[model samples]
Target: MDRSEKTVLTNMCMIYDDDGNVLVQDRRDSDWGGITFPGGHVEKGESFTDAVIREVYEETGLTIETPQICGIKQWPEDDGSRYIVLFYKTSHFAGELKSSEEGEVYWTKLSRLKDLPLARGMELMLRVFLEDEVGEYYIYEEDGEWKHVLK
Candidate 1:
């Protein structure tokens, strides 16, 4: 990696209901557009937590608070660029649902998640967040290959 290389910082949030269903987005215009969660890039000077809240409001027309930092997912590209996706989870939020330019927002039961089309690596991140054993870890990749653990 060189000084000119960049690491992009983004955030993702998984909001669930009492019955274990989660808020999901059926994306049609994004790279990983499919059945995904609410989230986007963290703007300049914005904290990761605040970014998730802002994203939730912008993408779902809802106001959420105290989203717990669950995990981090990173992928290094062949062009020397890197992406850091911060994952969060919240069972609390308030507002009405609204269609977003990003995608069609709705809820899907956890039991049925496997039956839907998921964004690339969505299952990995979801597993990392939902399972306690995985707690926090980072994935280092190059040319679309997982090169084993770094630590």
Candidate 2:
């Protein structure tokens, strides 16, 4: 593996409303262009909770309460490296929705998530996050296109 091929730890915020609708972002300049949650890489010396809070606010313009850690997803690339992403869910927050270089942000019903353009392994990840209890890990491998194997 090349030096550039390394697994990175990342964090994502699943901002949901009391109605179970989740906030999703539409990417305007990413290869994986579609509706996604607000999140980013964990910066040096930043706690997982802090990273998600900062990322969500930066991407959505909303100051979110510290989200509860819900799930962990390992997304493997063809090069054998993967991005380890932590997922959190929070319904309590304060601020107006806004946009950033990350993408346009909006809220969508969880039931309609499958209709939106999402990252390769997001379907399975979302399933695990919604259907399972908090604190679980889901491993996925991209088979080709947007298909994946969940383990």
Candidate 3:
């Protein structure tokens, strides 16, 4: 099996400030390192929603309220080699922000995102996720290529 034959599960949280800017992280310990939402892996035996809350707090030190399940980005494979990212969001949160070794946490105007350096595929995901639609999404590889099938 090649590098493509691997499975990973992760979660991401979009925390917005009162000014409506999104809290982003400059990742330091990830494969695709760059600007991204405050999130990380879903520890074994943890629920998706719980994972988001924990990840957000660990990375940004903000205790998030009920995180609404936004949507899912998944790459399905027969051999279980795939990536599934459960996305969550919560504007209602408390606690002072704290940066982590994971990266520098800061707030940036949502409109200014286009001018910043975003991780690969994050820009597109952010655009789609910002929309009103929260339907189930599917992304997989076929014939050595990737495809998107949204529902």
Candidate 3 lDDT, 1-151, residue by residue in tens: 5566676789888888678699999888667888889887988888888888888989999999989978777877677778788888889899988999999999899889878889877866784468766455677778988887665
Question: Alpha carbon lDDT of residue 49, candidate 1?
Answer: 86
Flag regions of model 1 displaced more than 4 Å: 1-5, 136-151
What TM-score, over all chains together, does every model reach? Answer: 0.87, 0.80, 0.84
TM-score pick, better of 1 and 3:
1
TM-score of structure candidate 2: 0.80
Q: Compared with the true structure, what per-residue lDDT tens digits does model 1 show for residues 90-138? A: 9999999886999999988988987899887677667777887675446
Question: Best by TM-score, which number?
Answer: 1
Q: For model 1, give the 10-residue run with minimal summed lDDT.
A: 142-151
What value does the lDDT take at residue 72 in candidate 2?
Answer: 82
Q: Model 2: per-residue lDDT, tens digit, 1-151?
A: 6467677778888888889699998877547767778898998788989899999999999999959988887757777777788888889899999999989999899889999888766777786568665354555534544434444
lDDT of candidate model 1 versus the reference: 0.83
lDDT of each: 0.83, 0.80, 0.82
**What residue pairs clash in candidate 2, if any at all?**
none
